[model samples]
Target: MPISSAMAVKASSRINSMFRILWLSAIVGMLAACGSVPLPPEPPIPTAPSAPRGAPPLATPEDGAPLPPARIQGRTRWQPVRWAELPGFTDDALNEAWNAWIRGCERPVPALARLCPEVRQLSIGTPEEQRAWMMQRLQPYRVEPLAGNESLLTGYYEPQLDASRMPTAAQQVPLYRPPADLATRRPWYSRQDIDTAPQARAALRGREIAYVADPLDALALQIQGSGRLRITEADGRVSNVRLAFAGSNEQPYRSVGGWLLQQGATRDASWPGIKAWARANPQRLNELLWSNPRVTFFREEPLSEFDAAFGPRGAQGVALTPGRSVAIEKDSLPYGTPLWLSSPGPLLNLNRLVFAQDTGTAIVGPLRADYFVGWGDQAGEVAGRLKQPLALWVLWPR
Candidate 1:
């Protein structure tokens, strides 16, 4: 199953290349600069109100004077809790999550930087030792929405595709890099505009980085904001490379899947559903692709063995660990924060320690999260259909 393009959301801005070039350097040496990648696209869902479901009225004073607001961050009220309150706290494989934590230590926040040495040492520590250290140094806070306990957990992944350096009869659809005049244009040529307008096409004429067979394939690459492109060059050389998000055309993103549903075109709005619709109604394929006005541009990067092991660098400027890195709403949880995620899943039940290493536009709210499921087809299958109830507890420094 393929996810909807709407799942694509902006990641952090690009950091320096030092990390890539010297990836094997000590964790501290690897902290050169931060870079950006886009969050995988999931279909758009209804936006929940930023406000909590219902907040209790402020306590009145004896003199009928309203009490000042309680100190809090974002739209959440952090309720402190005991470590035992977290379900499956002792069951998670702490060592499995240590890799993500160590990555965070590469460029740790002021509060957590001091703990880097300990975090690294504990990478191979026993679960009991790690658990004890956490309990000794961190406080757990239940992340509560102001109005309600409603929370959502979704999944996202990097897409992989076969591509070519030059356009071929089979691989005619082009994936482009940003145009020279992109910044000057308030909103660059749209998906439809680029397809139909000569001038718009001219701007991107020499900017094609690679070409793939299906238009939807190109769109998926754009929607994911980044992907693995196994490219066969014109000279008969083949290599696997990463296409990282460079920029968007500034046009607002619209959900083509949602459009299909609204138009009564199909009940299945997943990527597979969209593909089926495209196949059945080739004449309307352009109309479907053009429903989303935004266009994402990407730059190519060499995918090294080390890089291949992890997903693209997230908003936190570190490579994301599969099942261990989660895209969060930055307003509610800062990057690098450790979290206990418990979800009663109809697809997959997850109770583990994950990190707030990325953020997505759709991954908004105090409790909402998008789990990074890694790359390739298997991961895409999980990301495409994962939507379940969620609960989170943030482990903060004591």
Candidate 2:
């Protein structure tokens, strides 16, 4: 199903590549200069790794009492739990989660910022060491859905698509940059109107960075809000470019799957299911698309070696570590909070430590969350099939 009608928040560049490059160059130059004359070795001071391109420095925790009891609304009741209550805590690859936790510090939760120095030290440690650190520094609190014990967990991913720099007969669907009046306009022309209206077409003139063959593929990027565009140039050289979120047409989001279900067109609403219906009824594709008035816009970011590793930056403003990062309603669970999320077998046996690093228009409630499996088709498959019951235990500061 689609996400909520809640505004799909957009983000801009947080990382400055030129700055990182210049800093690294200066460091290299200094090291080269020092090589001529050997000096007494200095004790190693653990240097904090350069953070993701644009993320802000971790804020120093306020000098005060503990965070006012994290009482969040939307059906929440925190039940105190011990580290022993966390399922698969010992078995989890806390090392993988350590990297994620580190990225999270770039946008650390106010309460957790003070502990980042200790969290930083765990990066090179073994999983057992990481687990011990977590146990000693954090307290687990099981968040119950005051309504019941059960809650829903779904998934989302970064989708990759083949595209072209210029429009052709085969690649006519255009992916646009944000129009100038996007903010001034209440609701810009929708997906349908953008194609049909002359004024709308004029508004977005000369802004297309690439064109694709499938509208659904384009729609996938819009829904995900960010993606990679593998551009096949006229010379046959292919280059990958990232489409970071620029803005969106100020219209409410409506899930086409929900429209299909409501219209009695399909029961299976997964991405594959939706694609199947699109293929079967090609003529109604526009009808399905127009159901959602919202149109997401993007700006091309030069894909770098750094980008090749992690998924897009989430609402928390940090590059997400795939498989170890998850999005929950930020209002319910503060950003950068560590969590133990588990699901039953035969569906998703997700018993692991995940950082709450992102949020979604639809992700609300104390127990609800969306697992970020990773990027590409395999990740998409997992995300599409993941609508299962879940349990959560937030590891808070003691």
Cand. 2 TM to true fold: 0.81
Q: lDDT for model 2, on a 0 to 1 scale?
A: 0.75
Q: After superposition, how far is residue 91 of candidate 2 from its true place, in Å?
A: 1.1
Score residue 195 of candidate 2 by CA lDDT: 85
> Top model by TM-score, which number?
1
Model 2 lDDT per residue over 228-329, tens place: 888999888999988988888878889988999999999999888999999999999999999988888998888889778989888888888888888997
**Considering summed lDDT, which 10 consecutive residues are worst modelled in model 1?**
7-16
**Candidate 1 Cα deviation (angstroms), residue 356:** 0.9
Q: In terms of lDDT, which candidate is strongest?
A: 1
Where is model 2 more than 4 Å wrong at Cα? 1-75, 146-150
User: Candidate 1, residues 176-285: lDDT per residue as tens digits?
Assistant: 99999999998888888999999999999899999999888777767767899999998999999998889999888887888999999999987777888999999998
- For model 1, the stretches where C-alpha displacement exceeds 4 angstroms are 1-71
